[model samples]
Target chain A: MADANAETDLKQTPLHDLHVELGARMVPFAGYSMPVQYKAGIMAEHLHTRSKAGLFDVSHMGQAFLIGPDHETTARALEALTPSSFVELGLGRQRYSVLLNEEGGIIDDLMVTRPVSEEDDGKLMLVVNAARKDIDYAHFRDRLPENVSLQVVEDRALIAVQGPEAVAAVAAHAPKAAELAFMSAASMEFDGIDCHIARAGYTGEDGVEMSVPAGAAEAVARALLADDRVQPIGLGARDSLRLEAGLCLYGHDIDETTSPVEGAITFCMQKRRREEGGFPGDERIQAELKNGPGRVRVGLRLDGKAPAREGAEIALPDGPVIGTVTSGGFAPTVGAPIAMGYLPVEYAGTGTALELIVRGRRLPATVADMPFVPNRYYRKPKS
Target chain B: MTTYYSKDHEWISVEGDIATIGITSYAQEQLGDVVYVELPEAGRNLSQGDEAAVVESVKAASEVYAPIDGEVVEANGVLADEPAKVNADPEGGAWFLKMKVGNSGQLSDLMDQAAYKAYVETL
Candidate 1:
């Protein structure tokens, strides 16, 4: 159902030809023609990512650099728009944050990585969701002061090599990448091509994301794929991987009407931001943090193999609807159907019984703890 | 025995009053890697165009419609454990159900093998 013929106006990534050559099933996603899966199929791709390294073409996502006089100036300007402690973010570190509307709802969630060079102190590199990039760019362009500027880097392609073997496999091409600890980044050369590698990924595995010039993207991908442990993965596995990791997908899990507190992303709001309450929607966020959100995001495990897809109603036995599933599917890693959804805080506790109205059938389900598969991020021991 | 295909990619093989039904091979390829299946219960009466079964892949779920009015005779029990057979051989071992035809005339409206093959090319 997903492989509808792409509309003529849909955009294509730099690796479009390469994907087609590899027998990828192309589908229209977020206005771009992307590979949903290759010849190995989604099941095999998902399992391969869990056992080895899987390369993902995330080039459709927006990449940009925020430039200002110094790190303090840029960080302060950004902090005013989002609930994050950017000023305290150390060089080479990456932090996840959400752009919020005045009503305190999420505009989009993004990654902000500080380049690890003294000269690049004033520049903050950002990676925003593909579908929200244009809107996000327009929003930031309208808000930042005259001294600060946003530079959209459309000439670059982003690729993620994820799984347990990702670190060592990537290090084979650029040994400097091995030095990056989790949530960190640095500039490195891949096969003589200048690239930026980050020690982070959306999947629950330890991995590196590389930013390379558009022309060199395919070559970089080939260089990484040449490794025995690496295979080209597609968007199908990407969604399942992130879901099993308990991470939110922008439009599905968190959207403009969903607040961070209710979305279970309160971690993005650090202690300082929570106390000061200066960012957009801070008043309501602070209240929810202290009094507890009216509704909370929780994970669900279905009683059977029938997947409770997005928009399915969650209810008590013969009772009124209490919640709705936001994201759900058969988690290949868990080998069962899993879901994440919003429920009244009362029914959010793990092991709480519930039923999902899937196509008129009242399927039994239970609230469960997330990261259905434990995160396997590699963190270096403190010296 | 004569095989017929519907515009919606369903296929039927009729012998006597009983007709075997399943999705076409093209349909299975589009759905990709079937993970779960929900079949209409045996003995349920279904009208033409009514949903007869549901096939779910990793990304999406599709409803398989009844190509003709019929009374369900049996649903494939094998699919409960081996749904991927739908991908392996959609018109063979992956047949979804069998039914006693209620309207024999409806068979004339469906496409034969040659017609279905040409129809698939346009898709």
Candidate 2:
């Protein structure tokens, strides 16, 4: 992808050649040559994923295992560095967490999963943002005790099959993956290929993310593509899909200077961690949770077709600027322009009227509840 | 009647004192899947190189500048409902507007089809 010869320094995913063969328009992303869109273009691909299933190559993200002598040792050590309830994390269960700096700003958002069986040797698996992977590994290396070590799993490719039909499509090859509940993980064979499948994804859909060995990645991808429901989706639709789902794209919506509470993702910070207050930035995070953050992320619905892209100024009606847009775009699901930005608590209300300076014109907008489209994540019924 | 192209990828077809304006086929291909088009009002006057219209794709919004100074005579209303026409027929049905040519002298600066084809290859 990305012309392959555009820049010799850029890395390529295992599915890179497959994307090019599928007529994907590749672009530079997170230092890798990734597909931005296919021949169907962004709009159709986005709508198709919401209706059926879309397979995305996410191998650029960092995958690693924290190995220790036993479960308690690794879980406790991980909990010490992150604001997550990892100690109570049930076997086979996974929880989303943020790595924070000493001052409480987020270093990165990641997923930590406790292995389902003892054969994994008390390894806690982590999947971090592609751009923040290197920095995160360094951070973990510098802090872990001698007994605990980080094992980077670079010889693997990750793919996400998402949408309403994702479960049925994946269940065809890895039947056990269908039985796993939301936020659960299991090791299974996909068409005889070994893989680690997780019943989770970023698209706000009922989906599974599979991690397969590098050599077998292409075969796995081809098998998935053979299904009519699963088409190769590119990053263009991925951004819009996640935006409609109100999910944050790490570096765009949150960064080193943003707190988990300010980012409106305190739900990821479990209650036990909230009270125990042992992780980095607990002092600042706790204070913010108690006193409320200075600025909070909120959604905006624009009045017209002209989208208020990122970096647009958030202002009151003919008044002074109060915040800046972090992510904004033409949300195909909403059929209008939608934006997410951090605004003062007073202006974060759903009915608050605001203005966005887009393309040198003041566009009228109003604060609205997020997930411009409702989240369709599937949850099993309690017996 | 003769057609001229601008380096910015706009095309103008001149017939007497009236000229029709639209983006070139190459421009439409580069923009890809036009979802919306914003054209100037019929009576508005424009100078050569003025930002006359805006075309929006799924990923970005691009300006369509005036190729020659003129007063807008009419805008293609059909494009408002069917913006994809710009991609399907950039030069004919998707013309953005018709203008009363303000100065014929400005036409000398534009490239003919042969020259534009050569210029595009260099890009």
Candidate 3:
């Protein structure tokens, strides 16, 4: 719900008018007036993306590039800030990493990509959460080495076409983009429009995200929507899809207070980086990697239909409160209520009995393995 | 018998001193899918505008307020198992509760069918 102040203060995306034309219900999100759901509704939209294809306007996310003399300088400068291995990041490849604060808390999780072509040699493209972009930019400007600099791209609109039929839909315009392997990216043209297309997305599905010029965003979106298989999806479906995928949302599941290890996203950190330890809050993160954090984030599947939303107290069966739900809702694909929260490392095991105090009553719950719904991301086959 | 509407999107039907309450079709449409519903127990007394029931959709939870002063006579237990009924037949089998009206005069504060329909347009 957008309050009176929200309506006046929020910004609009490039496709704002198009969304309004499609009968979308706009809501204030991340300082932008974005669509929460279209005429098809959240449930129908979620199922449509799973069974078919859904297009989303992710332009609200921040896009930038780290400019340096070469990849080595840029990657090392970034490596000093994050715990991920970026020096060896293959060209055309992307990796998920988090920005750590001084104390090792996850400031934000971001996608780091190295463009494929020689013309784009010394640059590593970055896409960060909209809410934390300002903070991330400020930190990079303050901490980055003199040789490397951050250039935020403000003239581009990011669009994602996701789900089972996503590739087929996107291939109709950009055939070269469809050929790239998952987690890889390529700069291609869509009917003469130059864009950076990444074979990646937030939904647990095979898809691609196109960074297009803001002026031509509507044209690109309209061309994609012309395909019968693709429908416009809003933030509501996007959140549900990512939740079912066991992906963490920035402000909710992971925030400035939780480390990547405590957030249960250790995949972003490699073995070499862990042992060498040069990033911010390395001491705390390294300690957690070995001893394990006191509280670890885990998935919680409710025993009944009642959805336990964020802020619900999670406790032992008839026991004291142990943690709180950070992200939760009725998972459309799972056809059940699901949630994620932080719990003691001992109680984070799968199938551990748990209780969620939603409203006033304590409902039965259990520690379930994340990715409540299996991800169908495209995996490149071997020769 | 007459149907009255509250600004909170509840529909109330009164025949003599007995009143039946449920969310309107418009409310159901706004709420998308109704996943769960919490209804007040029978014999519970409610004042006008008091929170009587809770309705949860996939994304949010909304409280359904009592339309008028009343004592609960019965709750629709069918919704306990089939919450989708609220989206399918919001003002019918999905009724939240039936109550013995304590003061019928309070009904005047609510809008009639035609007035409520026009009022929703302004929103």
Better of 2 and 3 by DockQ: 3
Error of 2 at B97 (Å): 3.5
Best by DockQ: 3
The reply for model 1, stretches above 4 Å from the true place, is A1-6
Clashing pairs for predicted structure model 3, backbone only: none
Best prediction by lDDT: 3
Q: Which stretches of candidate 2 lie over 4 Å from their true place?
A: A1-6, B41-48, B69-81, B102-106, B114-123
- The DockQ of predicted model 2 stands at 0.38
Per-residue lDDT for A40-111 in model 1, tens only?
Answer: 988889999999999999999999999999999999888988999999999999999999999899999999
Sorted into a CAPRI-style docking class, model 1 comes out as: medium
lDDT of 2 by residue, A115-163 (tens): 8886875789999999999999999999998889999999999999999
- Give the Cα lDDT of each candidate: 0.93, 0.90, 0.93
DockQ for model 3? 0.62
The candidates' DockQ values read 0.54, 0.38, 0.62
Poorest stretch of ten by lDDT in candidate 2 chain A: A1-10
- Docking quality category of candidate 3 according to DockQ thresholds: medium
Query: lDDT tens digits, residues B5-91, model 2?
Result: 999999999999999999999998777667778888999999998999999876778999998899999999999878889999999
